[model samples]
Structures are given as structure tokens and as C-alpha cells.
Target chain A: MTNLPQNEANDPFVDFSDVALRYGDENGTLALSGVDLSIKKGQFAAIVGPSGCGKSSFMKLATGLCPATEGSIRVAGAPVTGPLKITGMAFQNPTLLPWRDTLRNVMLPLEIVQPHRSRLRAEYAKYVAQAKTILATVGLAGFEDKHPWMLSGGMQQRVSLCRSLIHEPQLLMLDEPFAALDAFTREELWSVLQDLWLEKQFTCILVTHDLREAAYLADVIFVMSARPGRVISTHRVDIPRPRTIESTFDPAFVEIVQKIRAEIAQVRKESKAPARPAAQEQVQ
Target chain B: MKAKHRKLAEKLAPWVVIAGLFTIWQAAIFIFNPRPFILPSPALVYQSFIDYRDPIMAHALFTLTNTLIGFGLGILVGAMLGIFIGSSRLIYAGFYPLLIGINSVPKAAVVPLLVIWLGIGQPPAIATAFLLSFFPIAVNVAAGLATVEPELEDVLRSLGASKLDVLTKVSLPRSLPYFFASLKVAVTLAFVGAVISETLASNDGIGYLMLQAASQFRTSLMFAGLLVIAAMGIGTYLICAFIEVRMTGWATRKQTQVTGGG
Candidate 1:
């Protein structure tokens, strides 16, 4: 693939201009709208907002998993018509197939996505070795062949992470992939995820409700409003790489989290208020 | 060696149970105190079984072939059609109602009708078995296929999987457990169909042997024929059980494959 010059890549990885996401056909209810964002290449961007703020819908638009109803979405410099292969994803649930063992689950994407899919069996040994290495990196070395139900919640989520990164796509989209885990596990995965991003600079869009997670992991965190979600604030997390829990306690990081939470609380307050009174008739 | 010992111990328990059953049966016959012609002694029954063993074996082989072929056909067609229906909403909506309606019909009533069309030989019996067994397999497999984890579908779609790839790789493999689960019921039902058809009219089959012995007033021989029929049913049941175990041993959470989905 020929490289696009810096000017062309003003927003190479993901661009959504006045994007609107809606459910159902014409005359159906709106989901979200007026979403304007441009994520630069190699940026660890996270979308942080309340539960129903269309964060997941923004994810769908970015990866072409779902199309925008009224606005344009261009990912990697192409208009997304359907699901794109260059973007990898992990959802809230680790939806591993029950029939396959853990190692096979990790190898599943390579066995499907081309040009690797076309030569999977022939290069299987090499791919397996890579899988073992990646599994080891995530502290899941010994449980490669165990069925999903046999593993603990954190362990299964680790496998889910491996499955998403197996293909090493240009972009990684995460939709609350760690919400179900406990505090310790979630913090541990944050380190692993941080190390992975450090090594491979793929453009990542993380959709999460955890403000702390957003501040901890993201270089850029966009705070969206309540339903009909609009981006109201963007915080640049000026923290150093390889950060730890202590960093989360730092005044700067804590202040960012508090600010994002307050923004969300304000949005909630505005949403619940009575319908606005019309401006009194005034002479023009 | 431990496994072999376990097998032997398992085999011993059943034999001990059957011997106790035999003694009770023998005692019950004596309690009735009927004449030899009406209710033959256990010894007489055993001897008749030995005398008719070859003809019984021949008829048994005939019945086995028909039931196995028809059952195999039913499973294959049922599984394919079930997957197709489960994969598409339009197909599921259109075919599911028709399938239930067909399954509710009196399958036995159609045997004579199938006979008139296909001739009253193995053809009709095989057809009868197919008709009796296919619906359960189809319905169960379709249910399993439909319930395949949607999350896995998302994974495939994200990986640029074609529609056929999703169906064949994800949907089809996911349904095997359900397909095999229903097959146990189908095998028994298919055996019943074959036997009932054979009893209705057949030149030579275990069912025909039972009929002939009854007509000739050979009570002991008829009992022996009945014993053979029971053996065949038990034997088919075991075969299906073995296959289910061998194929799905790894697909189950329980390491022992014999007691899975079925």
C-alpha cells in the first residue's frame, strides 16, 4: 500500500463529518446525531460518555459495521459501505464459539481473513507459534486449549483481546470490553493493552463508560452528551507512557476524570429538565 | 487395563440383573401353570431360539439394512434442510409451519399409501422409516443452528466473511450437537417404523417371522422371534450411541462423550 502524504492524512484513520446514527427506516426514532470527529492516524482515542450516548453506535460507524443514516463516514480514506476487514473489534461479551478450543479460537481469524486465509493450513505452524507468543504476552500461556466456559472471566477476556489483535489490523475498536471484569483485572488489562499499543501504533477508538479508563488509556478522550449524543468536551491526556495505578491517583489525571464526570452529570441534568419555554414574542 | 476392567465390571452388572429377571420370569410362568402348548417353558423357548437363529439372523440383516439406509437419508436431508431454514428468516417463516403440520399428521396411516405407490417391500418400509424420523432431527437441528451465538457472527462479519462462509463455518458446526441429540430419538422411531411395516406384510423379516410363528401356533418360536426383535432394537440403539459418543466427545464440557447432548 502506497503511503499517503501528511497533508492527505489530516484525518487518515477515521473521519465522521456531521454523522447521524438512527435506528429503523424513515419516520423511525433517532439514535444520535451531529457527531463530528476526526481521529488522526496512530492515535489512542477513547469515546467516554453515559451508557445511552451512542458511543457504541459511533464505533459501528467508524468500522463500517453499521452505516450512518444521514452523514458521511470515511475510514482509512475510503467510504465504508459494509463491514471493513482492516478494523478489528472486541465487544462487551467475549463471544467465543463453544465448539472450538482456546488455541483454535485465537487462530480463527487467520483461518478466515485473506491473504492469510488463503494459506492458513500451509502456514499454520508459524501462525500457532505467533499465537502462543501473543498468548504468553497476555499471561494466558498454559490455558490455550481449554474451553471458554472452563476459564475465569478475566482469562476469557484476555483470550478475547488476543482474538481481536490476532490479525493486527490498522484500527482496533473496543466497546466496553472490560466492563464485566473486576477492578484489579480491569487495571491489569489496561497495562497489557497499553503495552500492546506502545508496540503497535494502530489507531484505536475505545468506547467506554469508565472515565478513569478513558483518562488512563487514551491520548485523546472525547466526552459525548446524553442521547442525540454530541461531543461536548475533548481532553488530551498529557500523561507519560507505561503509566500505572499510581498515575491514576496523580492530581492531573484525577482532575481530568472529575471534569469528564461533571460534564456527563451536567448533560444528564439538562436531559431530565422540562421542555424549554418559548422565547417571549419580541419586537424585531 | 483399568478401562478394560471397568468394561468387564460394567458388563457383569447387567448380566447379573438379567439373570435375576430371568429367574423371576421363569417363576411367574410356573405360577400360572399353563399347558406346554399355550405357554412353553423357558427351556423350550431357548431351544426354539437356537433352532430359528439362522433365519432370524437373515431377517435381522434385512431389517437392519432398510432401517439404516432410511435413517441415514432422513438425517442427511433433515440436517441440510434444517440448516437452510435456520440460516434464512424467509425460509424459516415459510417452512417452519409446514414442517410442524407435516409432523403432526398420522405417519402410520400413510404406510399403506406409501406401499401402494412404492410396492409393499423394502421400498415402502424404508420410505416409512424416513417419514417417521426426519422431522425431529430437522426441528432440533434448526433450533440449534438458530441459537448459534450472534457474537461469533459479529466476529466473522468483522473479518470479511462471506455469507456462505458464516453459514458453513459458524452456523453449521454450531448445530452438530443439536443434530446428534435429535438423532437418538430418530433412530428408535425409525426402527419402530421398519418393524411395524414389516409386520403389516413382508416375505421374510424378523417381523414376518413373528407373524408366521403366531399363525402356526408355535408360541415358543414366536417368543424367540420377539426376543430377536428386541435385540435388534437394543443393538441399533447402541450403535447410534457409540457414533454420537465418538463424534461429539470433544464438543462437550463433560469429557465423557457418551452422555452428551443426546
Candidate 2:
């Protein structure tokens, strides 16, 4: 157990060995199967696959939002029974609380999760400062007191990012967190994420369908099959750190993206040939 | 400057119309040979205020208290139950239709029965207010609470918040703007309940006083009572509007807070 924590910190934080998941009692389709993966501590790993693949399933498993039907999954040397406290998330759209200003929205988790929750009243100032600092990190400093509707989409997204990282969790999950943004804003946030990850060195898991996004951000990229989504391949990104949009133009990143793209095409082709999925968008 | 002028024009138009209507009424009363007892006019509505100021004020206070109290309780309880129903399917399935059935029954139909059960008094009166007022609060609150974005809930959940936390922090907070909106409607309904109950059954309220003046052929006093009830209704309505404005500075911008899909 002692070596486990250190090994996690030194090597990787979460390990999924032969993980499998399914939805209901009808022996319905498997969302994921035979998924063995490890996201190293302080690493930015992205899961990119075709739509209908279990990229979201992988996210749910990591956060303990759902449990695997079979196999051993562990995070920080502990098996995930339910959601872990040491994680934070942001979604595609900037879903800031319309009732709260940007700062209070960011401080939401801190008031809910323990230790901080117990001390929210006493350490409100400190937490506010922390939220402001994170808002500043994402370039949302002066807009902290402004309500969510008053801000533009990009700004609201920045607040979302700030809210995710405000508590400074050990792991941050991003489920297509930038899919809703315009190209320029997406690129801007990519840098902001990169800077935050590099500074904090927190473990991260990002789910996206955009190949360029995976190639730009991930230290390792995992591709999954389309339906009974299994890990088709894991490609360790050999790109250097501190990457910019210019890095996306690099030959190496392009090659890796192309390779993943082909695998995704194959998976999608196979998925379409099989039996029809009754519900296309099963709320992931 | 042009924008500001248009905004001011939008606000000024309504008052100008109201002033015009009152002016026409004044002209009619003067031309029609109005007496103190017959068509005493808008002046009577005002002058009656100066005539029976103390008694009308006391009755207004009495009616106002019942409405405000019952309004408060109905809203508080209805909102809690509405959120409960909206959040859980089991509760919603069991209770929601029954709530609808209850609301569909005209509240005035049950006042006599309420008096029988609770004994012709404040309890019956208060119950009357609660029944009339609670429907809008409960319905609107439920609709508002139901429409919280699933994305927002997911964000909170992934942050390791419990279901209760998601409720209080995300769902409940998000529901507040809607609650305030429903609250506006609830306040008016509350006044309706109070005034309606007082009109039919009570002896001490402005509604009762109006009934007394009409029976005694005291037209001026009847007008006075009506002016007081109208003022009470308007006053209560304005208080609700004020509370909505003061509390929901964050709500006006949240179009999602209105009853609709998020």
C-alpha cells in the first residue's frame, strides 16, 4: 500500500485492467470492454474515438460515476466505489450557475466537498481568493462578480474551466469541454489548460472526438471501438512538452492523428454493419 | 440617448392611459349629477379614505396580515413540496395529479366546508388563502426545479458532490430564480384567497366591512372599504414585486428560469 501510493505518484495514478461496462438488465450492449489503461500522475491524457464509442463510459468509470461490471479499476491506490473527492470536471458548454456570479459559481464545489465544505464559512475569503486566482489563470479576473448571463460564451466557458480547477483537485476530467467553443477560443483554452496542468502537475483525463485536440493535448491517446467499445489501440504521444498551436502543424503530431483517424474509421465501419442501437444518445 | 428616450416612452405610456381613464370618470361623475350616496365618484374613493381613515386602515391591516401570513406559508410549503415532487419521479407520480385535481376545484366552493371543519374563523380563512395561493407556487416551482440543466448537475457530481449537495448547491440555487417568479404569481393568489374569504365569511376584515356598507346602503363607506381592499391587494402585490426585484437581481437574466425546457 505504501509503495502503491508512491508508485502511483511516480508512475501513474489510475489503472484499469480489463474493465467492462454495460447499461441495463436486458444484457444490452456493452459500453466498454477489455479496457486496460493507465493515466500517469500529472499527465494530460485524452481519449479520442469515433462517436458511439465508450469515451464517455471511460470518463464515468474514472470518476466513479459508474462502476465496471467486470475487472479491476483503481485510482490513487484505491478502488473507486463512488465518485472520488479529489477530482473536478468541466463539460462542453459553459454551464455556469445562472443564479450565481462567476466567482460564486467557481466556489460551488468547495462549498460542497468535504474539508473545504466544513470550513467554507471560516475560509470563505481564502476560497474566494483561490477562485479569483483560478479565474485569473483562465483570464476571467475582473468578470468574477458578474453573473453568468452577462458574460459571452467564451467567458462563461472560462468560468466553467475555473470552476473545475478552483478546488485544485488531483485529477481533472474534461468531457468534450471545448467542443462548443469556436476554433479560436478552443485553441486559447487549450493553452490555458496546458499552463494549468503544467503548473499544478495534476493528473488529467480528457474525452474528445477532435483528433487535433487529442494530438495537441494528450501525453497518451487511447482509441476505442465504436459500439461494444473496446480499446482498439493506445498511442503514446512522443511530442515534446509546452506545445502551442504551431505544434499541431508538426509532422509527428499529424502522423499520429492520421493513424488514430484510420482506426476510428475502421471502428465506425464495423459499428454500422452490426445491429441497430435502439437509443442513439443514451445520456452519458 | 435615442435608446433611453424609447425606454422612457415605454414606461410612460401606461400611466398616461390610466390618468386618461380617471379623468374621463371624473368628467362623467360631474356631468351626471352625482350625489354623496349615488355615484360618489373617484373622489369618494379618495375622500372616503379621509373620512373613515382609522377603521378602514385597521380592517386593511387585518386582511393584509391574513393574506401575507397564509401567502408566506403556502409558498414556503408548496415550494418545498414542489421541489420534492420535481426531483423524484415516485413523489411526482403519486402526488402531482392530486395537486392538479385540488387546484382545479374552485377554492370558494370549499370555504363553508373549511369553516365547518375549522370553525368559522381565522383558521378557515387562512386555509382558504393557502388553497388559492399554493397552486401557482407549487406548479411554477416544480416546473422551474425540473428544468435544471443536466450538464450543470453532471459538473457538480463530477466534483464529488453528493446528491443533496447537487440539490442544494446546483438544483436548489438554480431553482431560486424560478421560485421567485412563481412567488410573484403566488402573492397575488394569496391576496385573492384572503379577500375572497373575508368577503364571504369574515366580520373584521376590509372585505367584511365592504359587505356591511353595501347592506346598510352606505355607498361612501362601501367605496371606502373597496378602496382599502384594492389598496391591500395592490400593496401586497407590490411587496411581492419588490421582493422579487430585491431577491432576484440575478434571476431576470435567466430566461431558463421561466417555465420551459433548459
- Give me the candidate number with maximum TM-score: 1
RMSD of each: 4.5, 5.1
TM-score versus the correct structure, for each prediction: 0.88, 0.86
Instruction: Give one digit per residue, the lDDT tens place, for model 1 in B142-170.
Output: 89878877767877888898988888788
* Cα-based lDDT at residue B71, candidate 2: 87
True contacts kept of each: 0.66, 0.80
Interface CA root-mean-square deviation for model 1? 1.7
lDDT of 2 by residue, B1-262 (tens): 7756866887799779878987998899888877767767887777777888998888888887888889878988888788878787788889988998998888888888887888764676788888888788877777777888877777777767777877777777667767777776887787778777887888877778888888877888887787667666677677777677667667763433432213
Worst 10 residues of 1 chain A by lDDT: A275-284
Q: Which pairs of residues collide in model 2?
A: none
Provide the lDDT at A268 for model 1: 79
A1-284 per-residue lDDT for model 1 (tens digits): 42668787665578888888889987666777888777888889999877788887787778777888988888888888999998778888988876688898888889778888978889888899988988999999998888887888888888888888888888899999999999999999999999888887888999998989999999999888777786777789999988899999999999999888877877777777787332222111
Interface RMSD over true interface Cα atoms for each candidate? 1.7, 1.5
Residue A195 in model 1: lDDT: 87
- Which parts of model 2 have CA positions greater than 4 angstroms off? A1-12, A27-29, A119-125, A274-284, B23-58, B213-227, B254-262
TM-score of 2: 0.86
lDDT digits (tens) for residues A1-284 of candidate 2: 12345534666588899999988865777888778888877778888888888888888889898888999888887899987788888888788877787888888888877778899999788888888888888898798878888788888888887888877788899999889888998899889889988888788899998999988888888887776776667888878889999999999999998888977776676677766443232111
